[model samples]
Target: MDYIIDVKELRKEFTSHSSRSGLKGAFRDLFTRNYTIKTAVDDISLQIKKGEMVGYIGENGAGKSTTIKMLTGILTPTSGHVRVNGMNPHKDREQFVRSIGVVFGQRSQLWWDIAVQESFRLLKKVYNVPDEFYNTHMADVIETLAIEPLLDKPVRKLSLGQRMRCELAAALIHNPPLLFLDEPTIGLDVLVKLKIREFLKEINAKYGTTILLTTHDLSDIEALCERVIMLDEGKIIYDGALRQLRENWGEGKQIQFSFAEEATHAELQSLTHDHLVVWDQGSNASNWTASVENNEDIISAVIGQVVGAKKIADLKIVEITTEEIIRNIYEEGAVRNG
Candidate 1:
């Protein structure tokens, strides 16, 4: 019944000014201002329970960053209400911030000229972390993230991967229960990305740390989050389990079959529904491939038809990937908008 984050009718608006072009128009516009009101977040309401790992995702200009800024107290909402740990984040910034940690992948909180360890010490003083708590947390973080080797190196000299590890440690030094990760694995190689994902999983499992992750990487969402909230043009279009999202919007599973003898296109067409079969071609005289929808009944029917007519050599079914599902959703949105 307890929620770490609660938002109701949350909205953020900004006024942008436009200037006239050309010398004469610019001179005339100097005495006048043209301002337009843009809404960055539009009446969104969501609740995140304790220990929940939620993915906040959207395309560019979808207002993902705006929502996170409001939740973290960096920007105040223009209207509506937001509560983190039962306190208004913007109104009670000091006390509220202690309960949450934020990491901006494109930015650094550590001093550029200082060693990673020195930054941790400075954060200790700033957050007033107890010596025992700091030591215990740091030990766990260092081991989990493998940042021991990079401790003595200046933050500016560390590689992107190493610096990201240090950034995660700096955020966790206070042992905050909630974490907001904005593109935590951006620009990292595959190996480094896997390590970061593993580290996040470990922390969530060990500490039950609630995390709200925003990223362009669908892989991160698939690996780390059970539930997802998708945004489009400052509005939420989907909010539910990852599996459910796929079921609702995903292209069905792809079924591939190889036959003992080559089946002509007309012969294959006679076996299954025309729309259900996607690819119908043979690599050689005895090899052929075909695709079908994911429905069990459909698959069964297609298999029955094909097996009844010819000898089957091989069969494989490929499930729709998370990335493919998301792309479908985006394309659907674009079509609808257009």
Candidate 2:
């Protein structure tokens, strides 16, 4: 299994000038200025095998964009190395450019004044794609993405969903083996987001294109990516299977129950072991939630011990979501180096 993307000890920093305050401070700036160095991306390393769709997630200012920029050859790393498809992206600019595609949802790659088809045509020329291959691939993309009706419409006239589909088509027209998607579904409705997810999954399955995605929408991560790498404060805090991350960060189980009659808080608290009652529905309704340790194994036993079939009306138990798990990891305690 060959790795298409390899990164090692990548680091990036930015120096921002301090703003002058008041007249004295402004005049003092003429003589000297102060600057603060912000570590945007600390030393980080990872390898992505070919045909792998990875979800790269992190909080704001967590260096997600900085890492993307380095991987896409948009910015040179202050330190360390990055190799995509056996080429140094920054050094072999032409070769790298031809072998990859990028789409930033906040920005448009299509010409605003031209019809979607025309922009794709221009891309065909730019990538120097053969006419036969271009036609075949374009037809397939249009059909798969369901952009046939919007192809002839100018980009500016298309709805956000329509434009996103076109944008995806444009990025792949050249048939780059690797795709870098930055928030491809940002600000879209639920239906649109689902549509985009389906399209991306289809392309990856059909073409085996290696995809590196950076997104805030955890649903996108859950829906598309098999592996996830989490970053915080410019460092790789968690990296591995999404399941493992959830197992470690998430409490074992969330147990909820509704009784036919009100139950005392003391009785509920007494049933818990290491777990704590993070939320309670109150005695009036006989509903409550408790964070139980060894949740999976102990929950039922505790329920039996505590409730004792006290005419419970409803009961629900399930594993926590990715969002809740990640939140727990971040909020658990002091940040540790990884």
Candidate 3:
């Protein structure tokens, strides 16, 4: 009903020029131009309600960054419409930006030569943040991100993890209702990643900030987002709850069982018929694996039957991960097109 970000049939295209490599071909190309038009985003439609943390994910060159740029008003759409926080992001850039915050991991937004605290104060003044609110928020942010040690140092002198901590604190100084994050935890160590994730969770819970994150890290999605929108080759391929995506696109359960003795030929056939044995013992006769149907009840039934009939020696249940699910989707998409 109340949506903070709305897009309808959104599309963006870019025109690029290409020329031949050799000098002779270059001379011939002087009178002619080879222009190519590529669509960066194609017929994208999405809506995000307030306070919803969603992951916008895809492989490199999949148009995730282009969509973020359009949503943030850095680039205008080639066609269709985009609205954020009840205003046209491109047309109302000045007023629209006041309601949103952006952080790109590979770029620095803070003042390079100034101390972190100085940059924070400047942002406070720029955003017209009330002194009372700024003071209260600064205290909480400093403690939550543990950036107090880095505040006195110049932004250019801080390490990546320290700078990222300060960058997050700087983004929150304005208290924007909507935040756009592009690979916020990229290239950081595991400990720093954990700290940043915790900080993001607290910010979302405390300020009700709507976050649209684009990342190659599926772990970030698993920890932070319940919903996911997957893009591929300039088109939206999947959008749904994370759990539902896992259930619908997953490879189901795979388990390997090594028995002290093999089951009878009829017993093995019966199991294979219903269970879909993915790997079976030929010469070994005592080792095999089954990729059961993607149903809990079926898995339970098969496992119970195995325990009763076969003398179990070793068993392994392969765990399904979010990364594997996404990889499967991409592979399937490739097959569909090829």
For 1-338, candidate 2 gives per-residue lDDT tens digits of: 57899999999999999969999999999899999999899999999998899999888889999898888888899999899999998999888999998989888999999898899989999999999999898898889888898988999999998898888899999888899999999988998888888888888899899999999999999999988988999999877888766666665676788888887676666655445445466456588765566554577676675666467888887676788778777787434332
Q: Name the weakest run of 10 consecutive residues (lDDT summed) in model 2.
A: 273-282
Relative to the true structure, candidate 3 has a C-alpha RMSD (angstroms) of 5.3
Worst 10 contiguous positions by lDDT, candidate 1: 329-338
The positional error of residue 311 in candidate 2, measured at the CA in angstroms, is 9.6
Displacement of the residue 61 alpha carbon in candidate 2, Å = 0.9
Tell me model 3's lDDT, rounded to 2 decimals.
0.86
lDDT tens digits, residues 16-124, model 3?
Answer: 9888789987997899878899999998899999999999999999999999999999999999988899999999998988888889999888999999999999989
Kindly indicate the candidate among 1 and 2 with the higher TM-score. 2
lDDT of each: 0.87, 0.84, 0.86
**What's every prediction's RMSD, in angstroms?**
5.0, 3.4, 5.3
TM-score of 1: 0.84
The sequence of per-residue lDDT tens digits that candidate 1 reaches over residues 56-136 is 999999999999999999999999989997899899999988888899999999999989999999999989999999998
* Model 3 / residue 226 / CA error / Å: 0.8
